[model samples]
Target: MTALRALLLTVAVTASLSACNRRDREPAADAPLPAAEAPAEITPADAAAPMNFATTSPYAAVKLTLPNALKAQTDLHARLYADEVRLLRQFVEGAQADRSEAGDDPSIPPYEKTITLTAAAETGKLVSLRRDMSEYSGGAHPNTTARGVLWDKALKQVIGSGQLFRRGADMSLLDQALCAAVNTARARRVPGAPPLTLAGGGEWTCPRAAATPFVLAPGTVDGKAGGLTFLIDPYKVGPYAEGSYAVTVPLTTFRTLLAGAYADEFAGQPAN
Candidate 1:
């Protein structure tokens, strides 16, 4: 009987020990699971997402969007955001003042401003962007503008279009080509409209290449830039009614004028 009791006690102790071991090895029902590991690098879709902001009030309404590609560029993105903030503050103040003076004038519509920045092309260490802005402040019609930006990923800075050309290089050839292209585009938009003159009086005068904002256009060949697409805002080369114009100057037109550093970046033709 004593031996049997000892055996039973031994079995109970072993079962308890085993139960404890099992409890130690298993997770608690309420415990949180392990967190997922983040990706080592940003994916293309993540880089292409846009950062957007908007607000509306009785005095004004404002909207702004910045592409993730631009936002990924830390320094440039900071500068652009600072500039936008300043502009936004000014607009809000102006709108408030106008409202105060108007004293509930129903005819005065709420002032508005919308700005969007989008990636136009990316080649090598350069990313091209386009900015379109529209604003209205008690005007018959809203005013719209478009501009281009070239960001150097290596340098982490904005570069002017002139940098693509050799120092002291005569840009007259480029200007002539751009003018011809603009006139050709203008003719198609407004049938029988007088052709734009390179150096003529009035709003119909063709804007010089130096005066236009241009982005590196995507090319047919991968990893190579096709050409430059000039962004012309309203009232620059034509009446406001004609709206904006985008004219692409092929690489072949200005390939000879390219700086040694940028020559290799150009090839094929514009994708669109």
Candidate 2:
């Protein structure tokens, strides 16, 4: 999702709620980083499992687009080609590194990925993409501070109704697809690949970071390679008067897909 999509969805979901914000629920005064907790590993066994929330059914009224708060993370998915392997490697390594860095410390929340796929009895294609936000965003907030309020508000909006379709692909298959996309990108891309349609598109939004921040440089590579690619003007004017970007990854891979670029501050996820 481009920053514009993130912003639109954030505005849409957050408009009724509130402008938000986090740390590991960062501890203050005399507090020490807690022990290292287990890593957040998304496994097939875990995804096949049942979920505690309600599933999507043909009876569903509206397609629940993720609220900005929760959708933010899901949106991290860069617009890589369908078969970029190195990109996928970075994604997995990122998961472990991010969680491990947080550690088992008392201040950090334990990391784990709980993927629930509920096929609506009516429209089997539309599946509810629910997770244990309790884990992903646990420590991301703290006692109802101003920041906490914003973060919590965002997650609440996205958790329930967000829909997903792995192209009829299950958890394992999706994982494989991710790896495949990353590999394909590596084989096709030369070192120092120039900014292409999907390069700078790896942008994100952080209302709290800056009024509007550019996450990366004018040239940044979206680490995936897919068969179908969408091209856009790298410097196209955006919602915040910034720019727009494109990607190769299928639209289904992400939710709340937007069409905008950024100021270059909200680049791809940080290096762990």
Residue range with the least summed lDDT across 10 consecutive positions in model 2: 143-152
Tell me model 2's lDDT, rounded to 2 decimals: 0.23
Q: Candidate 2, residues 142-177: lDDT per residue as tens digits?
A: 211010001112222211101112233233432333
Looking at model 1, report the run of 10 residues with the lowest lDDT sum: 26-35
lDDT of 1 by residue, 1-272 (tens): 12212211121211111212322121111101112233123334434434766777787788878888866676556545544544555566667776666574776667776768788988887877787776666545666667766766786555665577888887888899898998899889998888777878655788788767788889999988899999887777777778889999999888998888778888999999
For model 2, how many clashes?
Answer: 40
Question: What TM-score would you give candidate 1 relative to the actual structure?
Answer: 0.77
> Runs in model 2 with CA error above 4 Å?
1-92, 99-109, 123-134, 137-272
